[model samples]
Target: MKKITLVFLLIILATTSAQALSWAYPFVVWSGNVYEVTTEEVKNSVISKRIGEVKTKPNDTTGNYYGNASNEYPKGTQYFAISDISTDTAIAVRVKKEKYVKAVFVHKASSHWNPYYYFILFVVAVVLFSLLGKKRFH
Candidate 1:
């Protein structure tokens, strides 16, 4: 029983490590709208008018923000207009919580493209091929 418990614990640890290594898309929901977050270099002149200030709540998770579904922004995040363009579709922003001044782009959500579906399909295909190949040979 002790050996069985040790094996179970090891399996759990392995699975948790694997999950930690997986990457997720960056997203944030604000003002009843969802935006995908990305970064790019923009001239200080292009980062125009002050739009809004980031009011990140205590419950907001800023560290692992990739899969965060909350509407709260990260602490110290401030948004600015992109030249003359500032709309629901696109905007220029800055995240000040990091070590350096980080410029970010907030774009409207496109579609739900969960990559895990493809991984699951590949695993199924491999299993089916192996099973069918073995049967044909026997």
Candidate 2:
């Protein structure tokens, strides 16, 4: 029984560590839109330009348009629009990067899954196993 528990813990640790190491491409939020670097070149260029930005806001169900019916740019706002030359996708916008908006601006989808949740679960499992092991030994 002890060996089985030890093996299970090792397996969980290994799998969790592997999952933690896996990297996902980050989504950039700008001008009420979510953009992802579609190519390695664009990723490198954006990093070099220091233009990567992200913002978190309440989920808006309306749409992806920059603004409402008025469609007026905010006062004293300087917009730097970055677009993918090939696909014509808007990548990022400099200035007016509000931190209260979700990254993706699709119709019904929310933000991506957060990896921290998995980490937290792993920690909880480790603690539970340690407690069980101690109780069993005693």
TM-score per candidate:
0.40, 0.28
Model 2, 2-82: lDDT tens per residue? 999999999988884322222244344443344443333223233112333332322234322222111222333222333
RMSD of each: 12.4, 16.3
Check candidate 2 and list the clashing pairs.
56-100, 56-101, 57-100, 57-101, 57-102
Best candidate (score: TM-score): 1
Q: Which candidate gets the maximum lDDT versus the true structure?
A: 1
Worst 10 residues of 1 by lDDT: 59-68
Put down candidate 1 lDDT per residue, 1-138, tens digits, no spaces: 999999999998888432232225444544434555566555676666665654433223223222223243564466655776544655555655322232333554334324566799999999999999999999
Model 1 scores a C-alpha lDDT of 0.52
lDDT of 1 at 55: 47
